[model samples]
Target: MLNIPLWKRVVIVGLVALGLLFAMPNAFYSRVEGHNDAVAAIEGGAESPELTAMEGAWPGWLPSSLVNLGLDLRGGAHLLAEVHLEDVYASRIDALWPEVRDALRDQRATVGTIRQQNSAPGELRVRISNPEGIAAAVQAVQALAQPIVSLTGVGERDLAVRSEGADVVVTLSEAEQLATDQRTMQQTLEIIRRRVDEVGTREPTIQRQGNDRVLIQVPGIGSAEELKALIGTTAQLTFHPVVSQTRDGSQDPGGRNVIYPDLEDPELFYILERTPVVTGEELTDAQPSFDQNGLPAVNFRFNVSGARKFGDYTAENIGSPFAIVLDGEVISAPVIRDHIPGGSGIISGNFTVEESTQLAVLLRAGALPAELTFLEERTIGPELGQDSIDAGKIACIVAFAGVLVFMALSYGWFGILANIALILNVGMIFGLLSMIGATLTLPGIAGIVLTIGMAVDANVLIFERIREELKSAKGPARAIELGYERAQSAIVDANITTFLTAVILFVMGSGPVRGFAVTLGLGILTSVFTAIFVTRLMVVIWMERRRPKTIEV
Candidate 1:
């Protein structure tokens, strides 16, 4: 304990230096953040003299990462949104219409004329013209049934086909509904994440709540309304072949065709085929652009498969009109003048520039599978966060000062070494937090204060042991060595137990509790290092240089 090797000494000093260097950036948090943002903007293809100067202000080689402040410390928007999973079920049933029609049409003689009837939200009802052929019609539709992939219903069919009166009703099975809900929730989460990330905010907390809801907390956003606006729309875009144009939305457009009102003129409706030629899922990119008439519009391009399908469709129906549908409303219906081989086209809706840009962003992020209904929302003001930060700062300073005074008065010069180690210990905690990008909440400050008080336990144990050794008439050097050697086990045992408790808290807790656990955990590690390695190094150097023959505890 008294004599550390040359390499060990070098390592100890190197670690302390690195900790100080990494923690230095947090002292000027805003400046470092500005520098980081400027660099990010430059990388994102935005260049200006001001951004260049800001980037140059902070050196690139220096440690620039700062500890992320939690939502409680930095004001933001909080929202609880319930995903409308039931909405997808109805859409799924509607989409199955085309498939069911095509399958039954292949065996028209056996199934006879098949017509759809009104059914429940998730059920598809087909009225068979020939009631005697119900069994064969059921068999034909059963061939289209898929196996459910859920664990509880692995061998079950995706659809439940049954006869109700003269109509055959097909509904999603329980297992299939469960699987669909899971997929819908996952897709909604991804789309929401993409939209939030597009706004360029840092460290937004987006997590699943229950089975059908999501909790979103975005720090630095103005209000919950603003955050909602970023992700409110469904943005479902599709292209359908136009059946006819009419002034009446009440008129039936014929079998498997629907009438959708024009977005600009509600009285005018376009009759379109229910099966779309292409959907937004095949879109690779969408950008805000100007149309041929210099109107604000969105330009979209398709992936390889979409391009081939679109190219063939346009080639076969050059003079036929296609309607561009947005959320069941026809935006435009234009005749296919020529083969659009490249699979890129413009959507002209006479939109404002802002609307066009927002549409482009939504398209690029992809459409939400189901709508999200905001259940709870609130805005956390910056004033409250500032007050909390101030209180936490005062608590930490008082705790730090009290610890310094107590340790200095108790063990004399050795206590002073412990205090120095304590300071370095705190610095190392911050350094680790910043390096790992861990969030610090108000509770995290309390953890730091707790750490400051606990940091001197090992030193107290060692000092008392040294006094006992001195009373037995051992030499000062032997007494010091025996003290550290004897007290090491107790120090390790106590800290190890405390560290395990912290790990449990971290694993089980969320939000501010997690922030507290992080700091508490890191504090335990740094305090142990500083107490054993740092203070011992200081004492060893002092003893070696002064050649003290006797010492007082």
Candidate 2:
């Protein structure tokens, strides 16, 4: 028998006890009382004032925030979106074909006609009068190719090309298209994750689904409309000169001036047409604040280059108005009264606090590459989440009671020891989750329940082994030792298979499914430790005291 020291056993128990003690508040207590209370002042918030205030009261120990629950259990929004890769590919090809045509023209190739063909998907056909110039034209077009490749016929001088379907199909192979698609999806996912993170969501789940879709799940998020507004709108900011009207039946002699729609007066203001000196991408920071008139506005600061450009534009067009256009709509158009030397400027307009903040966030994050459409949206209320939690708790308690009774009735004192270890195992899972700040979903709760059943299977294997060894006339201590040794392989094999399944599920699943996988994986690991270490420790202690000659199952 592998003899473990009493001190080692005591230390393990003490550590488990300490974990349970620290996890109590997270598992049960409410440190925040009011909804309007500052998030930082409430427990589980980024900066808990209560924790700081009580830091001195609890000596040499840090107060932790409450463990956050997931969307299913906590009731939150779920969104599934299919990214329109086909449209993206089409736009890319359209842009590329123009460039290719221009390049062909530059090559001095005699171009007859170039157009997209409906005969083949993603195919474009180009016909040229000069057969000798075909080689140079193809070379020129090749320079701008992305997911497209050129093909020359045996008897014809025409060029035929097709796109392999990517975000930007210049002239790319199938492998290259797949690679580009993966990269685009990954980059978009990162951008979305950053945007969601900026919204102060806790444990938000964002993952890529299939080759062209993304799934986002936010727990405890009640405002589906707000989230949809924030995420679905592709805030593509651009600066376009307003088209000017002519006095006569001819075009205006002066440049185009953009027309701004007045929100209050419904009057149109024709602003002088000026090319954008700088884009919003040069912006460094943006935040909502009140202007001199105390109206809600967004204060924005640009980089050095942007500041210089803005200053120059303001200096040159002092009397002319410039419009702040966002997503094709003119939000504000104020004449340059004075030169703006610094990179900072205020956008004064009619805005609520939420609108101002959202605008600032969008500007800070930069413009999206393409427009996004919302295909699905769902929200879970807090009341629904509470009910789930209540149901989960009842189910777990009943499961625990049933398991405890079955073990005790079948295996006697040893079964009671196993039950104690099982309880401790559950405590450890919660404690670890709290320590790591893992979000617990409804599926995650199911994972724990399933783990309880699996964990008992390991105990049953060991107990049956002990019974068999005792039937062979082995002493209690020897039988216990042989039981653990014989059962270790079977226990490890069974758990390993389950662990592999969890790993695969985590890899392929999205959102709630992933949460379930994570919880199941963690539960299995902890169960192994408790079933082997804690159970052995208890049995060894009992054997040391009672010195039973034969074991009973």
lDDT leader: 1
On TM-score, the leading prediction is 1
Looking at model 1, report the run of 10 residues with the lowest lDDT sum: 248-257
Q: For every model shown, what is its TM-score relative to the native structure?
A: 0.93, 0.77
Clashes of 2: 13
Over 126-205, each residue of candidate 1 has an lDDT whose tens digit, in order, gives: 99898887888788888889988778778998888888766788888888899998889889888988998998887888
Kindly list the per-residue Cα lDDT of model 2 for residues 153-215, writing each as its tens digit: 223322234333211123334544555466567766776777787777778888777777788
**lDDT, each prediction:** 0.89, 0.69
Off by over 4 Å in 1: 150-153, 243-261, 266-272
